[model samples]
Target: MKLQGTMLVKENELYIGGVSCKELREKYQTPLYVFDEDLVRNNCREYVKHFRVNKENNRVAYAGKAFLPIYMCKLINEEGLCLDVVSGGELYTAYKAQFPMEKILFHGNNKTIEEIKMGVELGVGRFVVDNYYELELLEKICEEKGEKQAVYFRITPGIEAHTHEYIKTGQIDSKFGFTLSNGELYNALEKLNNYKNIELVGIHAHIGSQIFEVEPYLDEVKIMMNLVKEIKESYNIDIKEVDLGGGMGVYYTEEDKPKTIKKFCEAIIEKTEEVCKKIDIKVPILIIEPGRSIVANGGSTIYTVGAMKHIKGIRTYVSVDGGMTDNIRPSLYQAGYECAIANKIGEKRKNQVTISGKCCESGDILITDTNIMDIKSGDILIISSTGAYGYSMASNYNKITKPAVVSVQNGKSKLICKRQSYEDLFKLEVV
Candidate 1:
């Protein structure tokens, strides 16, 4: 419904990066993932501007879990943003891309020992320690490696960020981090002192994902600041950085009004500075791991219309070749999206249709009850804002092959990820 990034409708045809969507569909085939290079770069630039500071004390790590490929990692490195990785694959992608190891921060709740080994071996900058086990394990690994690793203890601030229940991380009962309300946070910090190899530089807190309000983040800052002040009074140690995990919501539908990045950044910086001033503590390096907001709306999924089913007085079902295998956010988080007939844009919109993925599961719907122009077989259906987790979380469900990913910039396009062939579905399988 809304044109974003390089998206424009010329002569009623949807064009992204000055390239035609129909052309992309023809060249790359349907169920394609399209990322706008300039948009991603612009998002990085805009996010950097608002969150900018001297390189020594401030940084923005693009959460690579959103949509990570070697090329995109290269883009992130080129754009001068740090990379936040949560798994070995993500970290390995960064490593293989020759991403500056000093700019990578590792995170995960249940990171395998091998993953930890890989990160430490690759000289990752820091690890957002999730639990005591990871802290102890990482410390031992660092000791074994004869190296010092900086770390930030993840603190659960017990704030229920108003978002989907599945995505909330800062709540007290979450499986993420040490709960601030409990004594374990202090215990964890106190225990950290014994690990000589771990230099606990700061604390990290992520209230939740897909969050829209700034007040929650402001609350988180104040809460974390209070904790930092108390830690200072109790332990006489200073926190040098505070990584607020990114969850700035973006436009998924017309009714979703996400806060502007500028306003959000301003509020965060002003509040952090204000709190630091009030607490008489130095403003630490503020880190935000933005994944969805930075890349979500900058990408779209192109699917071809197949069969149409209309239940009398119910809804029209337009099946696309791709579904739950490519993008599962709709079913996983009840996510919403806006789609249009890429080849038939600028036409009179008279039909309301529900888009269905070809997945065998009944819950494999993409857009529910959307209004599109007349749809027909072979029509290109361009779904918006799928850059974040579409490809990253894709699967081979029903043995459906995954689509290729293309990055478009300045009317030029380049393939970033190759489509999975049927062989890819069972490449690693053994009889």
Candidate 2:
């Protein structure tokens, strides 16, 4: 198994963040999401440290959709990174975290009036305008509030990133942003000219998520910079901020090879500088919203193995207590993950088994056809790189309760999210 974020095997046991996984399983119970706090902090610091062209002009915003608990929000706030929230709930999370209001970047494709009003009332720093409706609606809201709002036009650059089809956002046909090839962006700009309450302060574009290549980002920078120049030349509008929304990938299995954070930062910074220098325009406030890369490898989900069914001459189904209830990635994206027997790390891999979850659906497989040590009921199974969308996309299928989340650091562990109880599921149901 590929170990990450302070993971090491000591005395034939797997340990993460200096805490033994066996102990974590015994204390926190199985089907638990464990994040290395030190690793998360270090990822934040790396982005803050290396992603710079001008110290004052660059910002790193943690995309909260990946995996956000209140504790995660507080950790991000303390790490000096900005927050990018897509909905009112995330905005509220940041607000509850007491994150600096001015450091928040609000983004969404179809932001509702209530959400826009919430951001406006809370005094968020930047609103990434997605479509014409939002553009006009935001102006109306600002006019009603008698306040001026700064926004970035999220333009689709038509770059097809190499990723799953569902995740590609920068294509011309995507629902995310105004397409650059079409006249929609120009029309939006013309509309912006008539709005007095809204200020078009920047431009934003996100190609896709879980991207492994840096060339796509360079392509994104080139196209966006050209748009900045055209807007400057045609409309004399100076876009002072440029947000290339983040999709940096992380290692999941042996087949996955992602770029280092420093390399990604260096490549992006160099490309932006080159384009700015070529266009003879000063670099705008460059921002990136990294979600998965910051948290993915730092997290591991530990589950207690149970109920082994051997299909003779075919495969073995090793069941775990958790499934789509706590992690839905494998079912959703056909995502592959590396796993190991936490307590039997040193054992020889002799069994090829499919890790099945407790969910009723047969699609609830977590890791399929993977080799691991011969395992019995009650052995611990640790899946790596589950920190990103595992819990964030979790569901209560079969009405199963969600698992708890804990962060480990320096041989210490703290619960970040409490496990849902049977009663918690019916908390909102009408009696």
Give candidate 1 misplaced runs (Cα > 4 Å). none
* Top of the candidates by lDDT: 2
lDDT, each prediction: 0.90, 0.91
- TM-scores, all candidates, are 0.98, 0.98
227 Cα displacement, candidate 1 (Å): 2.0
lDDT of 1 by residue, 199-245 (tens): 88889999988888899999999998877788889987788889988
Clashes of 1: 0
Which whole-number lDDT from 0 to 100 does residue 126 have in model 2? Answer: 94
